[model samples]
Target chain A: MTEAVAIENLSVTFTGGSKPVRAVDGVSLSLGQGEVLALLGESGSGKSVTLRSLLRLHPPKRSRMTGSIRVAGRDVLELSPGELADFRGGVVSMIFQEPMLALDPVYTVGAQITEAIRRHEKISAADARKRALALFERVRIPSPDRRLDAYPHEMSGGMRQRAMIALALACRPSVLLADEPTTALDATVQIQILLLLRELQRELGLSIIFVTHDIGVAVEIADRIAVMYAGRVVESGSVRDVIRGPRHPYTRGLLASRVERAQKGDRLETIPGSPPDLTALPPGCAFAPRCSLAAPQCREIVPPLAEVGPAHTAACIRVAETV
Target chain B: MIIGEPAHLPDGPDRGGPAQPLLSVRDLVKHFPVKGKGLFGKGAVVRAVDGVSFDIRKGETLGVVGESGCGKSTTARLLMHLIKADSGEMVFDGEKVGADLDLTAYRRQVQMVFQDSYASLNPRLTIEESIAYGPQVHGVSAAKARAKAHDLLARVGLEPGRFAGRYPHELSGGQRQRINIARALALEPRLVILDEAVSALDKSVEAQVLNLLQDLKDEFGLTYVFISHDLNVVKFIVDRVMVMYLGKVAEIGEGPAVFGAPRHPYTAALLASMPKMDPDARSAEAPLTGDPPNPINPPSGCRFHTRCALAEPVCSVQEPPLAAMEGLQEAACLMALPGSGHSRAPAPVEAAA
Candidate 1:
């Protein structure tokens, strides 16, 4: 299978007057065609920064990014301003967390979708309108003809999300980077959006990099999962392996802390302490202070991503001995 | 599921003690006039909180679950009297509460933790000053208020010495929420309304905050009206659960009864739609069709009848009242009503394709 997207040693730093904040440390990841990969993390875990880096969407004036980001056989960093704009909506499309903000309030849904189509393809207005309606139908938007005339503010949260998805898929991009696409939606709508994404991925053979803070959502959609913390991928594996039996303490803590399995009276197992500050991360393992099973070796040296089993890896010093 | 588990009822007035309920709401209705003006000039009313009634026992958590615009948040605001109800009776501790009731005294006893912590907290005020504001308004000495603020910060898991002087922008989302929680507790309010308190947080951070809430509930003997859009979180924290749709209570029951065996079709659909953390337990039911109806002229019968799959002709004509079921369970659906012919054989309607 061809690699749909490959990122190598990507690092993002926000430089100010004195000390620069490393928002994302050196990290490498790859996605195959039709593959769904979930980047799971808490706030400030650098998942959003990594996703923003894919299309050079980060603030360039303050953000300093290094390393190669290859999407659809093209180096994303090497593209010129005009080339980047053409590449953005054409090769790699993105659906943001808040659809209302991503969508133009003044423009009708049809107009936006048609603009997306017209930007990439030199089609007439009539042809673009037809394609927009078709895309709306593909996303299962009810009464596509009527919804095309509705503005973003006129639509419900779920409808707005569907429209956003329609816009992202409008240009038939090879890779879709969804940053918490369903976070603000209700549970039912979240499921609908997830199922739609999964269906579209199957039909279109588009690679997806899904970023979320909810593990349940990742389990429902992702083929592979990457658990990030501070600024690095702490663990990466197939969804089944990572969910069923996680090796990293952060992953284990996340699984154990989830309110999913507990009965009404069951006390939730909470991971004590908070996420480490990016500006002042601790020495060695960033999770050492909160890890219950932390050993002396964990505080002295940063662990490499050690493979525990086929397609399963964890960046922990005790990964070999823990399981 | 355990049947007739009294432990499910938190330490409230209705749980056999002589003390009265801390808050009792009857037929609560809050309607906000729609934005636009017309010849009828009054404009259509957004039935943010329709005819809903429930009681919050002292020192108990009453979880209200619904989607956005389902009136859960409106119900919270109504209980706090932050927004007045159009038509309803709010009785607190055996005393009938009116709009003219001295809000200052009531404000001291009722505190609210909002969803957007940053928006709720004053950017100009330091953490200590923010928390102290409530106590100061209640006529406490400046020294005492500052002391209470420090105590509240520690109670909500923030270090007072380190965080007291910091501004809202300096803290993380979770830390800001903790400050919000601390500010709510500053006055030692009897009832706390947590409106989607942990929804904006990461799952891990949410869990920690939930644990903190449970601890505080036990230690302070606090009564909570926990409102949220997430059912899974509600299931984990609440003792009794109320399912709302279109500004009405669709179902009300003990946590296990409501979650394990939902009576109303709307409740069943909502339960089915929730994604199970366990990958093997996925449901095959299609997601509910159509958005909730407009609240201005809500469906004639049951507010949910428009979207309800099992809604019959009667559901579109006669509004079903919230009535009790077999055990600690209540649903306001014609199908769940007694002598409705549909309740005779529960399995038939539920089991049929």
Candidate 2:
């Protein structure tokens, strides 16, 4: 299978803070063409940082990035200003968690989408606008034509997200990075957005990297799952394999704690401690403090991703014997 | 009228008259006026909560679930009397809240925990001070309140020695929430309203807090009005579930009944909308379409008709009243009633039989 996107030993350090925070540490991930990968983690998990890195969305002076990012045959780190501009929307585009903040407040949603399309391709204004309307319709925004003229503030939360998705897909990019796209939405509306994204990913043959803290959402859309803890992908495999039989202790703890897994009135299984601070991370595994199966070795040395099953890997020494 | 829970109602029936509910709310309404677009134009009212009513039995956690603008949070606020209702009657422990129960006294017995833990706490005040502030205002001596704060802090799993001197900014999200829970219990309130309290925490932390909450409830014999949007959490924690849509109660009953066999179309759609744990059983289509109609001018008759899949012409013509179904649950749906003019409804004779 062709690799649509790849990252080798990517590490992002935000130097602007009191201490240089290693937001993402030694993370390597790859995405196949027309596949969906869910990067699952809580806040400060570096899931968002990794996704933003794909677009070089971070400020260069404030943050130092050491990695090789290759997407659609272009080295992302090597792209010129002009090339990066085109590559952002033409090769890969992103939709954020809050559309209200992500979208420009002054411009109409239709105008922004049209501008995106026209910038990527040498299309006429009329043609670009027609395409924008089609994209809105494709995303199932009710009254597409009327809504196209509406400003970002005029739409509801769910509608704004739909508009955001339409804008992201304006240039027909091969990759779509969604960061908690449906987290702000209602359950009913959240399901709608998830289904819409899944449908669009299939129809467009788009390789999507969806980041969310909600495990159920990850299960709903991703063909593959990568569970991140304190900037590292602790476990990854096919969604079926990972959800059904998670090897990493953290993954096991997360799946077990879900309210869906237990009967009413039963106490939910909980991970004992909290996520580590990135700035002053422990010497070894970041999740060691929270992990139930952590041993002396776990706190002494960082665990590398090791194969446990076919196309499955876990970053824990304790899991080796069990696997 | 109190909606009694016949099956799961508390043990030991009253020796006197019929047992009174812990809290009974009737026809609660609250509307906020929206200024007109033009200065001279007529104003509009946002129907935040319209004629919502329910009963909170003793020693029970009643869960309210809904999307945004469904009036769940507003109902929580109204229950706490944080925001005065435009028109409603609230009865607490058989005494009318305003008529018999003094508002100040009532405030001491009911407390609320908001979603934003940090904002809820005073940054300038220490953890012990925050927790002790409540009791101090209610006439507890400073020394006694501080001692009680330490006790409550220990109960919430935060060591008083380590956490009492810390401010809100010094704690993590989970830790801060625990502090908030401790502060809520500082008043030794009978009823605690948790409005999206655990919604902000991480899944792992959320589970820990949930467990802590259950333990606290058992220890204090506290009743809770747990409001949240997460259906799975609500289903697991709440003894009774209330499903709301567009400022109206769509369904309310025993937790399992409401979740497993919903009587209202909106309730059924909501249950269907929850993302399943099993990846193989993903929902093929969205159960409901379109955002809920603007609350300022909700859909006529049935507010949910615009988004409800099973809505009929009668749904737009006449509103369905919340009434007991043939089964254990109570639903506000035309079809749930045999003679409610819905095509799919069972015949009156069949239902009667």
Candidate 3:
């Protein structure tokens, strides 16, 4: 069986400024059908960049890409301009962190979803409206009929996000890209949306790539976890392995730095330094400067991902069991 | 537990008289009028904060938590005087604000650090200049202010020599937030209101900043009104926790009591809403459904009744008062008090429990 999404050595560099920023560097990832893979990282870690590359969403004038991306059996990188446009939303749809900014303010929520459905298929407006109402019901939006006519601004934050999910799913894409969809919401609202997504993913057998910096959210929704740092996948494994037995020094630091890891009134263990500059990352391991176990050799060579457990892989020579 | 009593402070430079609360707010209320709506316009007022009252003790971190539009930020802004309140009274160190202590003097005693570090600082100013500007405006000598800024820079773990001359744009988000903390401290404030100050940082960076804040609090004997939506962070740092819903305090108590055994249904639901860190223990069902209701003319009584799992008919008719419970905890729930007309309320004999 073919994978829902496959990426190989994806390198994306933004070249607008004098010094180019290698946003994503030699990152490879794959997701099976109906699997939920979380691209976990802090800001500037390039998780979002890798997700966007699959859709060819970057500005052509400023960004240069040099890697192959395949999604749902289509060669994303090889697709023509027009075909790329068709591939977007028709085969792969994405939901953003902020629904207020993502949804069209002028159009009613139902109108937007109906237009999205009509955009990919030759369905009548009436049928599309019916489909849109069904989607609203599917996402459990209150008062589906009244909510359909309400504009994005008229709805509350959580309501707006439900509409966003309805719109994203309107085209019936096999793969979904969720970029921190719950980060902007409160804990109560976040869990509701998360549960909704999990139910929908299972019900529809949809493959999903979720990008978020929040570990708890990742643990709640993702089956596989990929920890990114300095534009590389430092660790990737089942959620249990990554969270319970994090191998990468950066990933370990991230887990230890959380509030629950420290006793009350105790100083939280930190990574000691900020992320490396994307434009001027060190020649070897970018995290070596801040890593506690860094040795002389660790700074001179960039470690490759090696198997630690049956399914776990980490990019640190010291921690890699294969060595 | 009430919202009307005003405290009296003794006239002196010494802050926080022997048993006095560092700051006390009474009947704090703020209602932002909607566009094209007058003060008396039909349901025009967005009751962002309605009659919130609390006391801040010296040297303790008081956390303010709630969902968005729950009036957490509005309450902070009112405390900071960033926005005028419709009705309220504040007593700082037992002295009534505006009456006993002037606005400028009151402001000097209290400082605020916002979430957006870059937007809060002046773009043209260097790190040292930004920190020193507060003291300079308050009539401190320029050289002394600069000297203090350098000392604070070192204290916050930023080497003064390296960071002082750099502009805001040159520093990272974590570094800029440190500068904001330094700026807040330059005035020698007794109370600091950190409104989601660490929310924007990464886990690693947030840990570092939180440590810095704890150290600063100890060194300066600072009282903190730490407002955030992250319950884990709040449970870790604050001595006391206040849970707000629809601009009203639902629960306020010692940290352990509020988190371990909450009396209010809203508080219980909020605690349950936290996603467990363990992957195997993912919650099967959502804690509470539906978004927080709009602030405009919120539900008739007990603002949380609409979504609360344990809400009864009385919850929508009569608002529960903040009844004092054991362990110095207070909750505005009918179930916490005996014979409050709710079937699930504690028995009169069990009221002492």
Colliding residue pairs in candidate 2: none
Write the residue-wise lDDT of candidate 2 on B1-353 in tens digits: 12221211232322122467778999999998888673324677889999999999888999999889999999999999999999989988877898887787677778999999999999999999999998787767788889999999999999999999999998899999999999998877888999999999999999999999999999988889999999889999999989988888989999988888998888888888888878899889999887777788888887777877788899998888887865568998888767779897767866452
How many clashes does each candidate structure show, in the order listed?
A: 0, 0, 1
Predicted candidate 3: interface RMSD?
0.7
Superposed by TM-score, candidate 3 places the C-alpha of residue A118 at a distance from the truth, in angstroms, of 1.6
Judged by whole-model lDDT over C-alpha atoms, candidate 1 comes out at 0.85
Candidate 1 vs candidate 3, TM-score winner:
3
Q: Which ten residues in a row have the lowest lDDT in candidate 3 chain B?
A: B1-10
Docking class of 1: medium
* Local accuracy of candidate 3 as per-residue lDDT tens digits, B1-353: 11121111222444666578888899999998788754346658889999999999878999999999999999999999889889989998868988987787788778999999999999999999999987777777788889999999999999999999999999999999999999999888888999999999988899999999999999977889999999999999999999999999999999998999999888888888888899889989988999888888799878898998888899899888888988879999888878878899877875353
Candidate 2 docking band: high
Question: Which pairs in model 1 have colliding backbones?
Answer: none
Rank by DockQ, highest first: 3, 2, 1
* Per-model TM values vs. the true structure: 0.93, 0.96, 0.96
Taking the tens digit of each residue's C-alpha lDDT, what string does model 1 give over A207-304? 99999988888888888999999899999998888989899989998998878877666788888888888888888888998988889888888787
TM-score of 3: 0.96
